[model samples]
Target: MSALTETDPTGAGFSPEGLARIAPWMDRLVDEGRLAGLSVTVARRGRVAFARACGQADLARATPFTLDTVTRIYSMTKPLTSVAVMQLYEQGLFQLDDPVSRVLPEFAEMRVAVGGNRAKLETEPARRAITVRDLLTHTAGLTYGFMEATLVDAQYREHGVDYLAREGTLAEMTARVAKLPLLAQPGSAWNYSVATDVLGQFVAALSGRPFADYLREAVIGPLGMIDTDFFVRPELMPRFCATYAYDRARQLRLFDDSVETAFAKPPAIASGGGGLVSTAADYQRFCRMILNRGTLDGTRLLGRKTVELMLSNHLPGDLAAMGTPRFAETSYTGIGFGLGFSVMLDPARAQILGTPGEVAWGGLASTAFWIDPAEDLSVVLMTQLVPSSALPIRRELRVLTYAALAD
Candidate 1:
């Protein structure tokens, strides 16, 4: 089948034949019924090198997937929240090292879970308060309820500490999280958690407005990410894609139908952790700002120095040194956590075809995007599938895309 792709890839150091290599691979997945549909965009030096969408967006409806189709971005929301909060930082609102409790009093005195399970929890006072830096780098002692790995997280599940839940505001949920015991002492380990949700509240507390409002005005609006938001509008429902998950037999099954999805309406909580829906085109604009070093067409969102700090590795070493290496957005070996994105310390160690200093992150629904400063590149993959680990698409695309680079 033919694909809707770029007419020319030469302007951005991409081999036209090399880009041709991507279509058949992408088509094979859809042909094999591995993915319902997917949209990919590869840009270099502020120009589109390659773009394509293959297969059905709504398999049941036989809807054709297009580049503008919107899908849930999930955890990918972290980077935007990080950038928004950092804008406040550039304005001298708060320092990276400042205690988050300085603005939100809920996190003033926190506890760490030292022993026991959800049934019989044990704890000790946090060695220190969770800091803005900790939240940004995920060094904060916070834990996600769904981890199912530790007593702290178990308690999180027991307490119904869910960010996706349609009830309660960000402020109410932040208070709920603060009341729970931390998985580790602040800055002790790297466990992916609801720290970004807390950062959302931190944004509201500092800005004296709602999290959604601040994000829209400061980050999403300024970057011209018009289709990126907490929920899809009624008029845009036709462009929303359905989400999927594998059944016990490893067959594709509808996870969330496109027509009747929570994303169709504005959410109550406005999760900063995993709650935005965006199109491949919209998200690329956001990536373009990062590649442009915190400015897009004279709409400067952050200072150049602040952008530098966001991309730098905040952890002392690689994520593997962070301990035990729990399930995270990226691999542990040579990957490092920057302010928001995962920094590639050494592509060889991570065993991926990526450049050193490249920053990237993915959503829970198998959607991913990476910005490479060294190569002046950004790639976005849009798809709807739960448990992003269900398939090796992210790494596979990494190999395929990097192999297509002419320079």
Candidate 2:
């Protein structure tokens, strides 16, 4: 029941007592059987402020984890990809509305899925070619590895579309993806998907560099996010936490050892949407950059205007196109879908109680983080818990964490 505290890196007013509020919940996740290992960090005004780790790196012993322990950040990579694309945006690499075909040309004539037998499927020109903005906003009418039940899914499988493998290049991924039909027309509906992966290819095509190299130089390098990358170096392997999934019996258990060398080096397919590993401390560097409005410390990754554009919700009404809003019970009712994360505008409508303008996103592995510029607060809760089972934990953690700010 003891409180954990750390000094704020900026010597700001952010106090350890703020983090003390969530100490019990973090402990209970281990004590009550919801998680095997986890790390939580809350920083305000450029400082660590609070950090804690509990349970064993593995299930065997309750040995504490370290800041270096890497966790699969799954979709958290979206924000990074968003930043990369936005970096190009700031440089005038491509206007947001430019047709995606302008860069890759592969998706210029893509088809849309109309359901039913593959043999009798209808084919037509995409209402509009996918745009650069579409890729950033998840409205590119694309699908993910887990979506679809027909030829498209089989194509994904046959193409060996492993987002984590260190073999296929971004161009190769685009060619494979282009062959598959889109589930919707560009900018017509929202579907959380492989759009960012396409953006990765976009980065390669426009920058004339590999997606991983572009991200490293354009995003990670400038932000000093050293621990965030496609692969965890061999020396850092011990800190790479084992990923867990719902077992056949519906229990949490370790799955694979970092998805087949993904954490070792840049995979051939750079999944801008979902394929990256990072540590809590490392990811803070990225979040802190966003919270700072495109600048952190002194280095600036985006213009303030561009940051505003990135954080603002881009989805139109008729939310039917996008997949069901995830984690509504977390009080996200007034929240609307943005290009990369969820945007909270009317806390009342979203039935969520956070400050307005609070934006957030989570990875499939239950990793979640958000920045509330209004409150000058940032929260990151990391765990290997399955996405579904961890919902209660995330809601409780957010409510409890925000409640402490009431002080």
Candidate 3:
């Protein structure tokens, strides 16, 4: 029942007793069979205040979850991909409003679904071309195949426009996506689509290298995210954790074994929307960079103004109220989608303990991280569970974290 604590590097005020509550709460979830394992890291004013891991990394093997245990961060990869695109943006490579067709000719001719279901769909010319901004904000006329309720979503599935399919290269998969009809017109509605994956291809096109290679050489390498990548290396496979999903009985069931996961090998497509394995420490560095206004350890990835623009809400006049279906457990009531993460507009409307302008995002496996520039704080929680909505753990973690601030 003992939890590990790290000496506060910056000596930013934090109550030891308040921080003490985290591990026990996390342990309770593991003991209750809600989580196979979990790791939490909290920092304030650039100081490491709390770092702890509980339960097993691989329950079948009885492996203990450690700080170094790498886990699939899934959709959390969006923010990182956004940063890469912004790096190119900083270099005058492309403007946010530029038509995506300028770089990826595949999107030059796109269509929008007019009516009918997946069985008999009707199409018409797009009102306007999809832009780079649409890709960053999920306002593009794209849709994910898992959103089967929509006819365009069904088309996405039928055409194999999957982020995790591991079948063809990103260019090929995106071409397949282009062949499908868009769910909405550009800048009209929000659909959590493969827009970021398209952004990754855009990055590669702009950087003159493979998306993975540019990400490594430009962002990951410069930021010192040594353990973050599209695939885990052979020697590091032992540190990879198993993923789980709840069964019909509401008990833990193996989803993906650590020893036998697609992440252990190079993926055919580097999914910018939901692909990447990283440790808590590695992700913390990435968060720290964002909180520090795009610089960490003398490495500058973005300009201060660019980071400010990324954190601001770009949706027009309460577009968050456009009633987009909640693909995950997120409540968009008082939330706004920024370039890469969700920005809290009003604390009361969100009905959660948070500050305005706080930005955060999570993964399909339940891993999440948030950066609070107002308080100079960043919190990261890592665990492996499918359908991240299974538990309200992220909200709970936020409450526990904000209440622990002593300053």
lDDT order of candidates, best first? 1, 3, 2
- Candidate lDDT scores, in order, read 0.88, 0.72, 0.87
All candidates: TM-score: 0.97, 0.89, 0.96
lDDT at residue 106 of model 2 (Cα atoms): 78
Model 1, 1-407: lDDT tens digits are 01224646888888888888888988998998889999889888777888889988899999888998989999999999999899899889888898889998888999888887556788899989889999998889888888787777777887788989898778888899999988888998888989999999999989998999999999998877878899998888888999999999888999999998888788889899999998898888888888888888888998888888899999999989986766646899999989999999999999999999999999999999999999999999999888888888889889988988887
Q: Looking at model 2, report the run of 10 residues with the lowest lDDT sum.
A: 324-333
Clash counts per candidate, in order, are 0, 11, 0
Which window of ten consecutive residues has the lowest lDDT sum in model 3?
1-10
Per-residue CA lDDT of model 3 for 225-343, tens digit only, reads: 88899999998998999999999999999999999888889998888888899989889999889998999998799999999999999887343575465666356778888899888
Instruction: Flag clash pairs in model 1.
Output: none
lDDT of 2 by residue, 170-246 (tens): 67777888888877778887666778888888888888888888998989888877777887778777677766666
RMSD from true fold, candidate 1: 2.2
